[model samples]
Each structure stands twice: as structure tokens, then as C-alpha cells.
Target: MTTLEQLLDLPRFSDLEILSAHKNLERKVESVEITETPDVANFIPKNAIVLTTAMIYKDDQSKMKHLLDTLVSKDVAALGIKVGRFIDDIDQDVVDYASKVDVPIVKVPSSQPLGRLLYQMLSYIWDAKTEQLTYALDIQKRFSGLLMHDVNLSRFIAELGKIINAPVILLSPWHKVISNSQYFSRSDHPASFYIEQIDDHHYDKINEGNSSFIVKDLKGENVQVLGYPVNVDTYFPFHLIILKPEQIPYPVSEFAIEQAILVLTFILFKNYKVDEFFDIMKSDFLSQLIKAKTDQTHDHRNWVDLGSRYGLVHSKYYRLALAYCVPNKDNKTKLIYRQEEAAIAKKWLEAQLPLRIKNVIIFKVKNTNEIALLFQSQEPDANKVLQTLADELKEALSIQLCFAFGNPYEAITNISSSFIEAKSALDEATRLFNPNVVNYYHPKGLVGLFENTNEESIHYYCEKILKDLAYPNDQSQKELRNTLKHYLDYNCEITKTATALYLHRNTIKYRIKQCEKLLGLSVKDPENSLNLRLALELSESGNESSEQAEPGA
Candidate 1:
């Protein structure tokens, strides 16, 4: 992992001058190899620093040009040539091309033997490799001792950063943060957001054979992310990311990451049975909570054990937050993909919830495309925590989600009430304003009011209000009535109705007047418009026997 620049900075080579430098000085040297002959097609090891006398190409310019092109195409680290041997000096075109391509050319003093020079470069690289190995071993020992103290994942990952002198982050395959070195804050550019954009195909384009790479931190910054990629099979693909990669010793960091991966895999396997039990508990607890069964009637010990097993610090207050992944029907999502997504989304939230707030338990609602989280948070500004969680869901999974949440409640038996409220909020919000977002229950929402109502009552009410308006037999009149509905919804604003219907303002006004004449309702009056709006809503939605009847029905 020794760089050409580092080699030049050595005391013995301080006088060695760089005649032409490569565009990239950070290219690592694999080894030093001598080009025995000046033939342009000679095999060169990748990332090798090469030494050539160029005695064979003294009289032939094309041969010299070919030689330089061959080295550049072969990905040589840099070239060291004894300038005064047979060729006095290089042509301007060759030097310019070398510099432009980032192939650094070093001019060796005439007295220096090519044999000794190549040996010195090899010695430097070997010594660097040795030092990096020792550093990696020290890092492994430090992390290994943490197992005895029962340190958490956050501290374990943070120590890795301190040892390497780099900002570290651990991420799940879905790009959810597992643990990170607190040395860096995620407020500026979320790494999860960017990494989620790079899928497996993109990885193939950028990653080397060993699944490690130096890619631009998806943040569109000048920073290069050095990542050691590893997938934890069914759970998630994960890896270590080094933010300040300039401080990274590639050999040491990569080696230590290998050790970390091994340790983590072993730890997960050791807890595999407990994890399986927790998965079952998640489903059972979620079902009971949805049914509003508490310690009073059914199994009190079950709830207590569930919370204790998962390390949940429960409080009196509980709120239901759903990370619901509404499928993209246009793209035709498969059933298997949906099921896997539900599970993965569940795991993602489970990992992140513990980080943002205490007293949280997450559940994967079976047969539904949603992950439910019940948080008993003491944080005053907990809505911010919910917003952050919602953002992470979108970034980590790369999907649109409705982060619908309910108001906090005191009793565990009232969980079903909160669940219903949260669901109603999501349904109404999606129907009215935005598609993907956090939605709260609105008492005025059409669905919220009629949640307990049956379809028969709603249809009957709509038929009574606007019988003829409901069935606009004539195409033109039907269009007019439809416009009137939107017009009334927009508070009879001609401009808004026109914009919503993509029609002219005058057309909207004419349509509204036609509707008023037919339905016997004034478009401008609040009283008439409210009744007409309710009728339009009832006609559009199915009937329901709600607690509150439709106005004027």
C-alpha cells in the first residue's frame, strides 16, 4: 500500500526528482519490477513500479512512444528511468502524455544502478506491508477484549474508528445505520441515503474483485469512501465505511475489517436462537397489542417477558408508528418481493429504533406491507425522532412510506384504538393531499369520520342528496357536474377548480352554474356547498354506518 510519493519522500531518494508526475499521486504500488527489454508489449504486473534504461529505443521514436503507451495501459504505478543512459532526454510529447495520464516519471542520477534502485523500492513496499500487518493485529486485539466487557455495538464500532484514525460507520444492506463513530454527525449528508442508491449492479461497476472499493461518498462531495463490503446472508449485507480515507492505511484497515467481520458473524450465530425467539415474540406481541389485550385480562407475564427479552424500557405512554411500504402498482411488485420487503423493513427499524429513542418495540404485521413500531419515548421532541425514522425508512429501503403515527395513550389495553387511529390517518392523508408522508388522524377527514360505518348507509345517503347529479347520463353534463364537485371542494374558487381540472376559469364557472341549476344548490353559499361536497364525497366512496351521519342526509 506504499504510494509513489511516499517512496520519493524517503531520505535516500530525497534528491531523486520527478520529471513528469501522474494526475493521481495516491495510486498504490504493488511491487517493483524491471523491464528487461524495451519491447513495448512486455508483461508488467498490475500496480508495479517499473525501471527501464530505454537503451533499445535510443534511435526509434515510435518504439519509445509505444513503450510509454504500454506502461500506461497496463496500469503501472510509476516509471523510474536513468535519463543519461542511452537516451539523453525524453521528447516533450512523451513527457506531456505521461504527466497527463498520471504516470509519474522519476529521473535517476547516472551513478545510481538500476538494480539497486528497484531493490530499494521493493524494500520500502515490503516494510510498509509489514508495518500495516502489525497495526492490524493490534486493532484486532483491542476489539477482541471488548467481548469480555459486554460493550454494545456502538462502542465496538467507535473504537474501530479511533484505532484507524478515521470516521467509521456501519450500515445494513438497506442502508440503515447499525452503529457509527460519534466523531461524525449525519445531519449534513446522510450516508444511508446515498449508499442505498448504489445497488448490486452499480457495485459491480465500481468494486474490485475483493468487494472493496474507493468510491465517492454518495454525498456528491470530494470525499472518497473506502468500504469493506460484506453481506450477513439473510439478515442484511453490511460493511465498514471510512470517511477520512486519506488517513486510512489500506492494508491495516482492510485486514482489521476482515477480523471484525468474522467476529460479528460469530456473535450473530451465537445469538441465533435468541434472535429466532425474539422474532416469534415480535409477531405474538403485535397481535395481542392490536387486539388490545393487556396484563389485566390475558397473559400479563407475556408482555413483561417480551419487553424484558428484547431490552425494551417500557413507559406509561405508547404511540404506534407504521413504516408502511405502499407498493408501486405500476411497476408490478411480486408477492415474494413484498413479503421480503416487509421482513427487511422490520429488521431495519428494529436496528435503528434502539439508536434514536429508548423504550421502543417494533413488529412486522403479517400479510400486510407494514412494519409497526410502538415507542414509549420520554424525549420531549419525539416527533423529530419520528421524522428522522421516517426519513431513514425511505433512504434505507429506497421506497415510498407512510410514516403514519397515532397520539400517545396511557393504557396498553387501548393499543387497538391507537392502531386504528394511525391507520385512518394514513388512509385519509393519501386520499386527500400527499401520497408518501407522515399522517395524523384528522377528525374532519372523510374516512376518519366513517371508519365504523358500513358501505350500504353511505351509498343510500349519497343517492338521496344528488340523485340526478350522481348519474349524469349526458357526457357533457356529467363533465359539468364533476367540475362542480371539484369547484365546491375548492370553496367555489374558479381558478383553483380550473387548474385542478386543467380547464379554463370561464369553463369552470359555467360548469358550476350548470350544477347549481340541476342540483338546486348554490355553489357560493357555504351551507349549500358543504352539503353538495358531502354528497360528492359519499358518492365517490363506499357506504358505511358511521357514528356521524352525512350533513343534511
Candidate 2:
């Protein structure tokens, strides 16, 4: 990683004259070689700084001019020629030509530096390689030690941030700030305020090179932002955001980012494997419990004990919540990436939710975009706490999460009922996609009725009950269906229904009369009203399903 200019500053070569092409001194030197032959271009590989005498030209200045072109093509790092011996001075034309080709041509102080220069370059390369290896080993030792001791994740991240004196943030695959790093430890505002300034395209650019990029402020202030991608060993579900030190020079900042990513990979990859093992076992147990396939021999002690070990306690009420993901355009293209996103998301939620809710068991629902968690709450206002937890999660990550809960299950053995209820709520939320999210545990009215209804049966029942009411001819006007539903919603109170619809009472009456004539049923009768309400629910569900089935949707 040391550039040619840095290698040249070996203290031994401090007296060497840097004559021309000073700007090219930043070229990185990989190795060093000596050449005294006229065809020196063929003697060295790319990034090798050449040490040679004037005998390299064989007394031909034309060949020397041509040699500069050859070195440029060969990708030579720089040329340090011993002067005042064979060739008095590097002629004006040669210096100009070297400058034009961006080749730094330096004059050696003496021809006797052969022994010292070679030793120095080799020493520098060896030292750099040693430092890199040592850094890698040290990172693994510290981070892995923490993992072994079950250290808090915030502590894990805080240690890294301190090592470099820079604020660090970790983001999930969908660009949600997961860690809520020390960057905001003293601040109340969300990470989105600062994160919004940097675009995801920055991630794509840095990832292309598999390295870091420093963005400088355009107004000439010394502020810089360093972007680094942290793949969980080729799984791109997260990235580490680093705030570049405004005063500290680069390569150091760059080196820190690189080193941190290595440590992160080591820690996360190992944890991922460990988490995968436990998740599979835990998920299997949950699945079995939900399906009533418990082991009868042990009286389900194994299941109960396993759940207890994972902190799935039972109190006055046990609630199940299923988190559903809102798929974006990019998620469709990268299935594996999307899966890891959900997996990492589950881990993130698991880590933080426990700090608030003491008794919770969180796990992914197996190859699905759903994450399920069961928690025990003893408080009288249990649902309030659950609702706030869901809201805070959505706001903190800035993610659109559709949550469904199951009504409180008193017995742990009957928790399967809660799972079924939550799943039903999630499915209906996905279909209706209304309110974009369902905050509560229970589904009501038409949404609840069509929870598991088949598409054809729903359409059939609506068509039969509503007659021509379901098929509104004017595409923009869903007037009749909506009006009838709202009328029944207000218990056939014309004034209340009209105000809710933002229409005149006379208009609402006319629509109801139209519906009565079309369906051959009056809203005044309780039996007829029940059928009308059921028809409306089916009709709405059918319409929603149709939208999802649209060609380009």
C-alpha cells in the first residue's frame, strides 16, 4: 500500500534530487530492480522503481528519448539515474520528455547506493506486509473474544469507533440504520437526518471497487465522508458507515475502514453461522408447537424448556406479532440479498427489542418475508406497549413494516391459535394493502371474513349478492358499492352516512334506493342488510385481488 513517494522517503534516499515530474512521485512502487542495459524497459515489471547508471543509453540520446516512451508503456514507477558519471546531465530534452510522460526522473546522489536502496525498499515492503498481517490477527482476537463472552453489540461497535476516533454507523441491506451508533448517543434526532444526505449510489460506487471512497466538501472545507461496504463474507446485507476524520490524512483513514471491515466480517460471519444453527432448531420447535405435533412422551417438557431458555416466558397474556416486509423494485432482482436483509433485520430486532421487552422469542418464519416474535406481558395495558414497540421499530429504521398481532393467548399450549390469527391478519393486510399497515392484532369486518377465502369464491358470492352492483360501469365512480358499505357502516343513518361520504343526504338516499332496486333488497330489513354488508366485503376483497393481478403490477 506504500506509494513510490513514500518508499523513496526511506531516510537513506533523503539526499536524492527529485528533478522533474514531481507530481508523478505519488505512483506506488511494488518492488525495486536494477538495470544497466540499453533495453532496460524489458528488464523490469510494472510498479518497480528502477536504479541504473547512464550506461543504460549506450551513448545514444535518440534511444534515450525512445526509452522514456518505452518505460511509460511498461508502467515503470519511476527512474533514478546515477548522475555526473557517464551522462553529464539528463539533457533538457530528456527531462521534458520524462515530464510529458508522467515519469518521475530522479538523480541519484551517487552510484554507490545500490546496496542501501535495495535493502531499504525490501525492508519497507516487509514492514508493510508485517503490519497488515498483525492488524488482521489483532482485529480477530479482540472481536472474537467479545463474541465468546457474549458482549453487547453496541459495545462491540463502540470499541471499533474508538480505535479510529470516528463515528461509525451500520446500515441494513435496505439502507436502514440498524445500530443507531454512538453517533447519536447524545442526540435525540434519527439517523435519517444525516443518512439522507448520502445517497445509496455511493454504496454502489464503493462496492464496485471493493474499497472505500472519500467525498470532499465542494465548498473547500476540510470535511470528508468515507464510505465502506461491509459484506457478511460476500453476502451484501449490510454496510459500515464511517465519518472520515477531517484532520487525519488518508490511507490511514482508508486503512482503518479496511481493517474494521475485516474484523466485522470475521465477527458477523461466525455469528451468522452460529445464529443459523440455533435459528433452524428454534424455528423447527416453534413450527411443531404451532402445528400441535409436540412430543407426547415427555409431556412437551423439551419444547417448554427450550422456549424458556430462549426467554419465551408466559405471563397474564402472550401475544404473537408477525413482521411483513414491503418489497421494493430492487428486492425482486436480488432474491438472496433480500433474504439476508430479512435475516439481518431479524437479528437487529432481536438484539434491541430484548432491551425493552424482557421475555421475547424472535425468529424468522422459514424462507418467508415474515419475522415472528412472541412475548409475555403482565401489564393491564399490554396491547399499548406492543403497539408502541411496533411503531418505534418502523420509525427508527424508517422501514414500512406491516405488523399483525394475535389476540392474547392465556395458555402457552394454545399459542398456536395466536400464530394462526397473526398470519391471517398479515395476509389480509397484504391483500387490502390499506392503511399500508395493520397496527392491531385482530382483523375485522370484510378483511377478516375474506382472510382465507378463495379468489373465485369471493368473486362469485359478490356477483350473486350484489347483482350488477359490483360491476360499476363508470371506471372512476365506485359510488354505489362505497355508498352502500358506508350506509351500513353508519347503521343506515342517512345523515351520518352522507356526512361521512362528503355528499348531500339526498344524494346518499338516491344511491341507496338505486342499490335496493338493483339488488332487489331493502336496507331497512335486518336480514337484507346483513347480506348487503357481506356482499360489500367480498366485493372489496375481489377488487383488491384484481389490482394485484394486473399485468404490470
Candidate 3:
């Protein structure tokens, strides 16, 4: 119960009359003394209504002045002066002083005992208490009913506004107006205008345990504002309830309006979860669409073989890629709803990009990092699709992104290769001196190493080079192999390859020449160079050792 109600309910104040007096009368009675000594002034509480006879004053001018000074300092609520006990008549000076000071002074005649007056005062106090309690209980019941009935948030807010007799507005964490009550709408008020008027900095200041009141100018008019943070243990960081017409005495009842807002927030969050449930169902449906599209082109039997070869039948292929985009500091900074937003972003990618890509994934890699477009797609222009996806993502999410396109292979057997190449391309893209899209297979300086060549042949070439380096008295063999491997790895960038091996440009040139002389093949001729490298790799393998050793046994 409120302090006023508690004071009114006290039995000692049963006969109290709450005088409808001006500030002058209140100040007059506030100066009247009920205690003999000025020290007792300190004993009176701030809100206490003191009743007394003027015996303490004794009608001495100096003594009366001293008593009044003490009473004023103590801030007594209302002073009831018993007039007939000593003075036989109410003093004109006291009455005039009480009126001037705006204190309600009751003229208690001697015929009316002090006990009877006290009884009447206490009864009046009890009635006021009952009235306030009734009002508070009614408000509580209304809120409880709203909660139990699962009232819509908008309607609930409107009802609360009516209860408080003020205009109310609810804003999302983004400061976007979600709902308001009827009173606000009826007052020629523009909802968007108020939403825009809200200071974002102030909105951010709200938390579960804090509330504040402020005066703000809205659309040319000053409004009293009481804003409280609504905390609901759900997806939203906070729900804001704003009240206007600050004069409305938001009673200091512990049954805060935030309790109502929190309940509404829960309902809204539950509904949002339901919406997300449907979104996931849609995502699953899109995944099926991608699988169906791919199935039309490749035989199912091939998938089985690929899966078996790669030991990936049970491996859920969550196709994924990484991309760099322009940072949206605002949206990115308040990155709530991560999983839901990612799911939606994935669907958006599928709808906008080529249908061949499936299971597209987009998620935050770090504060400024982006991981995007993990899906199964077999478009020949998969790299182009990745670029388009980055563009769409920038447009949709308001962020610019750089993409690393994983290989679009039909079978899971090649996922490892695709992931490695994609990662390398991503690294290359990040490190490139120029601004251009980079793909795994189309790396600027390293394309030759990753060309569509037989894996066995490539492995054989590495083996041959290593074997040749181990030969007796072949001092140039190691340098030659290093040069070839670096050249292949860097796609023939003389600067990069030489730098990588910590060798001078001239040294790299000399090694290449040595490799040509030893292999009897043109080092620069693409076909001849590949054949020589393959042969070298095969020669390094120990299969020939077993054959030679067996014959000797």
C-alpha cells in the first residue's frame, strides 16, 4: 500500500479531517507547536499529522514564536490546535497566523474532548486508506486478467495507457514503434513522428532495474515522459514502455506496469518462435529443392559411389563458404536473432542465386568477419553465383562482402579438395594487391597447380622430383625440385615463387634450367613440363625397388 494510504489507515488518525486548504493555511498550521521543548521537534516524522493543545505555547509572545519555529522546522503535516483548554477562546493571532502559513488548524472546543476529535480524525484516515487500496487492487486484478487471457500486446498496452490515464508507446530495441494505446492515436499524434523523436541514447539507458522520467519536446509540444525497461527472458534485449503527460501521478505502487509489459513480451516472443518454426520448415524445403535439382543431372548411383568412396554417406554435407562484406556496424553490432537471421539469409541466397546451390549458410565469423553461402549447387558459373550472392547479401543485409567460392562438385569425394582450394582462394583474395573476385580453381598465380589434372599424375610428379633430388652426386636436383614445386604452387609468379623458397630470381632461373637439362624436356612448355614432372614423381615411388629386390631373391 502507498504511504498516504498507510497513514490514513492508522487508528490514531481516525478523526482526522483532511482540510482542503490553500498553501498559506498549510504553512500556518505547520508553524503551530504540539511539543513543550523544541528538541521534541526532531521526534516528529515528516508525514505525521500532529494534534495538540496550545498549553505548550502558554500565550507568551516570545514562547509562541519559539514553538512555531520548532514546528515549522519539523515539517508537521497538519496541526490541530485545541482552542478552549487554556485560552477559553481561539486566539485571533493564532488563527490569522495559521491562515497565513496555510496550515489547517481545527478549533477544538473544550466541550469536545480530545479523544472524540482523535477518533473522528482516525476514522476519516481509515476511509481514505480503504479507497486507495481498492483502486490499487482493481488495477492489479485488471493486469492479472489481461495476462491470464493472453491479451494481444497492442491491446494490453492500450488498456494500460487508459489505466494510467496517459498516452503510452512501445518501442523495439531498434527504437521502432511497435504499438500504442488508443489515447495517443486519438490525439492527432503521428506514431512515426514520436518514434523518430525518441532519443536512441536514452532508450539504450533502460534496463530491468532502472526507470526514469524526463521532459521531451515532441512535434513542437513538451511532453512529460516516464520510460521503463521491460525485461522478458526471450529473444528481444528489451521492450520499452513510454508514458507521456508526466503530470499523471504514476503512483508508487510496487505493482509496476513493467510486469504487464513483460507478460506481453513473452507472448510476442512465443509468437516469434512459432514464426521461426515455419522458417526452419521452409529452409528444409529449400534444401530438398536443391537436392532434387542436382538429382536431375547426376545419376543416384554415382552419388552412392561417391559417397562410399569418400566415407560420407552419413556425413551431412553442410555446404559452406566464407565471404568478406562491407561492415554494417549498426545491424552487425546489435546482432541478436543469429540463428533465425542466418536461416532467413540462407533462404534469400537460394531465392536470388542459382538454384543448383543448396543448403546455403550465412553466419557471423567474427565482429567484422562473414561466413556465407554454404550449399549444394552444381552451376558451371558457381563462382559468378558467389559474387552475385555477395552483392545480394550486401543489398539485403546492408553489408558488402568478399566471397571465397568452394568448388561445386557433384560428389562428396571431392569436398576436402574443394574446401582446401576454397580456403586458399579466400586467403589469396584477402592478400591480393588488386580488387577482383578470386576462385579456388582460378587463383591468379596458382591456377596451373590446381588445374583439372589427374590426381595420381600430380602425386607421381611430386614423387619423381623428390626421388631425383636423392640421387648420388646430384647437387642441382634438390634446387630444381624446389623451384618446380614453388613454380607450380605459385602458378609461375617468379617474384612469389622465388620469395617463397628464399632464393634469388637468378637462382630460380638456374634451377629451372637444371630441371630442363636433367629431364630433357622444355621447362616452359605446359604439356612437356607436366609430363616431365609426372615422370619425376613416379620415379621417386618405391614400386620399382620391390621388383628389383624380388628378382635378386
Candidate 4:
């Protein structure tokens, strides 16, 4: 489309001077029509630049104001007046009125014939249309040719930016930048500024497809940006964005963007197809590796082969950790069962893991709520690395995750043992600490030592050591048990125990003596305290097992 500003640059309209509404010079002019009568405003079309000599309103300033008002209401593009032929000059009041109503008024040369002016304006508009058509076809040809080569997504985005002379960015479904054009780095502001300014509703509109809009930048200045949704294989969706600079007058070529989207969609679809196959292989390998046994009689060739392909060497020390989502207690009914959040978290973890810590392999555990990570290192820093990773994942995904790590093993063949240890550690960590904790397997710990012991023996031993405290038949007995546990936790320090239980020192001493009398042993003795702690753990574990075994637990 030909705009008023573009028409002003033509040689034929070189003498035309804009008298008002200079800011609206970019108003579009689709056709030029002559105003023959005072009521011509009623017949003029929208976006039509009107040509008139002011013959009907030359004598009456009020009549000129009325005509200007009607033309503004009709949404006319502009008014071109032959100043000398109708009146000596346009009245100052009339010019001010046109400016207030945002109607551009140009002073047409008095000697120029109105009929010839019409022909020139119409011819310029037709020629502009022809040029735009040609530009569209050229955009299609250039972008379509890029598809013939096996270019990647970044190359496609760079080409789009070059053709449009604007910045381009491709974002994942979760709104993370996937690829960006070089123009973004050369700008005064980073591409992130524009990405952050776009509202959520705008993304939603683009997700539904066929949408374009202008949004404000970080400085709240109007910036035109176009969004296109690129859905790959109907499973992964992406947002393709174009930032139109204010200095560029022409609208971006839609055909060019369409071709780019088509190419990007194909590339991503192909990538996902290959990724899907790779993921299947990885999943199968993980299952076999985790289930392999140390027995020499059993066949272990499959895990060894799979491990070799995935960079798992037999000689390197490997530590395994399992990560899973912990639903909010207040909103347990709204668990993250949807694949969207899980996919985003998994992708973020995969990308951020190598950046933060090296020698790591991350994969989905075939559960929407879980991921498995294997780290190869001889240092005892895997726990810290996993904790840092958990913290970053929580911050980035806004979802709490618990990480349970297994003891490091020197051989890849023993990865199955570490996996089993991780599974047990996860259960014990959730029960012993908070659900969202990062914990490692300690084989010498109380829970680890007796985790496989007979349940009946554990119950019998717990009851024999603590007697009434095991069952806590009365409130006083329960208080004594709690005070004893606290006292033991505080390292048998009377003052600390008193402070922890919020009781006087004398009361704590009396409670400890009563516990010793009931158990026939010194409550503060090191051996007795260790036994009591173990008994307490066994009692809690038994209760938990019973509760879980209950119907509909």
C-alpha cells in the first residue's frame, strides 16, 4: 500500500506542503478523489486523499470547519487544497482544526490541474501495489530456496531477519529463546527486553495462530512485533517473533514469514523424530542397566553394550540421582500430570546441568514426574552438585523437586546397585526428612542397616528396649518419650534439652530419671542413647508400614 509519506517523495508532488497533522503523514492513501460539492465528504471513501479548491467554503470560515469535521469523521486520509485559486490562504483557525482532528492537510500548487493530480496519485498507488506483489514473490522464492539446503533453524531465522531488515527470535513452547538473529546483539537493548515485554495474552493469541500485533518495549515506546506459531508434529509448539524497527516504513512480508515457519516446522519435526528414536534407545538402556545384577552367571552383555554407547565407561566412578516432583500439600489434587510442565522442566534440567556441572547424563525416567541423572566423578561432590541442580530447577521451573543420590560405584556394571540404593534413599529421605530434601545413601545409618531386617524382629527389639515408651499408653508416657528423644538429639546436654523441650532444667532431669527407671538403664549413657534412637526409628518405620498397608491408604 502507498502511504501519504511515500507519495510526498514523488517528483510530481514535490511542491505539496503539509499544513497540519504532520505526525499523521504515514496515513495510507488507497485512491485519490476530487471533492465537487460541499457534501462530497458523504461520498468520499475511507483512506481516500481528497482534492479540492475550497470553492464551496472560501467565503465562510464556518463552512470550512464543517467540511473539515465531516471529512475527519469519514476517516479520509488527507486533504489537498489549491490555496491560491479558492482563497488567499487557508485560515489559521481551519488549519488548527484539521491538526486537532488528526487530518493531514496539504497545500496543493494552485497552477496544478486537479484532474492530472488525480491521475498521478492513482498511477503511483497502482505502481506501489505492483511492487508489493513482486516483493512478496521474491520473498517466497528466497525463503523457499533456503529449504532446499539442509540449513538449521538458526540459519532460517538469520535469513528472515536479513530479508525484513529486522530482528528475529524463535522461542520454545515455554517461552525460552531457542535461536535469535544477529540483529538482536547489535541493538541498544537485548532481545530479552522485547521478549519480556510481550504479554501472556499475546502468546496465547499466537498459540491459536493467525495473529499479529504491536506491543510496547521496555521503555513503554510502541514497537511493532509479529508472532507466528510453529507447531511441529502436533506435539511441540514454538513462537516465531519478528521485531519491526520504527525506521522501516514497509510492513514485513507475510509470505516470507510463512515460508520461514514452514521450513522451521519441518526441521523441528525431523529433529523430534530422530530424538524420539534416540530417547527410546536410551530408555531401554536405562531399564536394563538398572536391573542388571552382579552375579557372574547372569548375562550382562546388554547393559555393557548400552553403557558403552552412552559414554558410560566401566572404569569411571559413577553416582546416580533421581529427581521427581513434589506436589503442593494445599493443592495435591492439582498435580503436575500434564506433559507440558514436565517437558519444560526436563528440558531446562538437561540444558542447565552441563553448564553448572560437567560429566553428567540426564534422561527421563519414563515417568512424567521423574528424571534420572548419572554423574561420573571420583570426588565426593555429587551430592552438592545435585543440591545445586535441585535449587536451580526449583527456581527456574517454579516446582519443588527432591533429589536422592546413591553411593558412588567404581564400575559401570555396578550401576544397578547404585540405582537400587537411590530408590531406597528416596523412600527413606521422604520419611526421615521433608519430602523436598536432597539426600544421599548412608549404608551405616540406622535406617540403612536394618532396612532389610525382619519386621517382627525389629518390633520385638523396639518394644524390649523402651517398654511402655514404644506404645505410649498415657499422655505422661508420651511426654517422657518426646523429652527423651529431644534430650538424645541434643547430645544429652541438660541445658540444651531443657531449651529444646521448653521446660525447666529440673523438669528435664526428672523426665530423664523417670525414663531411666522405666528402662532400667541410664538414659544419658552413650550405648543406651544409641539404642533408644534406633528403637525410635524402628517404631516410626513400623507405624508407617502399617499405615501404608491399611485399606485405601
Query: Residues 1-553, candidate 1, lDDT per residue (tens digit)?
Result: 6777778888988767788854567777878877757653467778888888777767864455566777877788777777787878876777676787667777777888889888888887888788877876876677678755666678777777776667777766665577787666634566565465555554443234234434455456555566665544533446656666678655664566677766655554445456657777776767776774544566454555555765545568878877666667642357666665666666666766677777777776655777777777656755676667667676645655567777777876667777887877777665643464667665656544765578777777666677676655666655765777677778768787677777777777777777777767676887766767777776664322122211220
Instruction: Please rank every candidate by lDDT, starting with the best.
Output: 4, 2, 1, 3
Top-down TM-score ranking:
4, 2, 1, 3
Q: For model 1, what is the alpha-carbon lDDT of residue 374?
A: 79
* lDDT tens digits, residue span 1-553, model 4: 6788899988878999999855657777888998758788778778899999888786786677777788887778888898788787988888898898888888988888889999999998888767766787777677667767767888888877777777889987656788899897777877777787776688778878756688776678788887888986343468888877443335444554576677778777777677767766877778767766645544647554556676665456788887766655644565434354455566667777677667677777765456788888664665576677667666544566778888888777677888878877777766643564577776766666786689888889999999988867586787778778788888889898777666788888898999999999987677888899989877864332211111110
Residue 19 CA error for candidate 2 (Å)? 0.9
Error of 1 at 318 (Å): 10
- lDDT at position 197, candidate 4: 70
Worst 10 residues of 2 by lDDT: 544-553
Task: lDDT for model 4, please.
Answer: 0.75
- Runs with alpha carbons beyond 4 Å of true place in candidate 4: 8-17, 27-134, 165-255, 294-298, 325-337, 379-402, 411-414, 420-437, 441-553
CA error at residue 240 for candidate 1, angstroms: 3.9
Q: How far does residue 424 in candidate 4 sit from its true spot (Å)?
A: 5.4
User: How does model 1 score by TM-score?
Assistant: 0.54
lDDT, residue 418, model 3 = 53
**lDDT of candidate 1 at residue 513, scale 0 to 100:** 74
Number of backbone collisions per candidate: 9, 0, 40, 0
Q: Indicate which candidate wins on TM-score.
A: 4
Candidate 2 lDDT over residue span 154-231, tens digit each: 677887776666777777655667674575676555555556656656767756654444443434444356666777
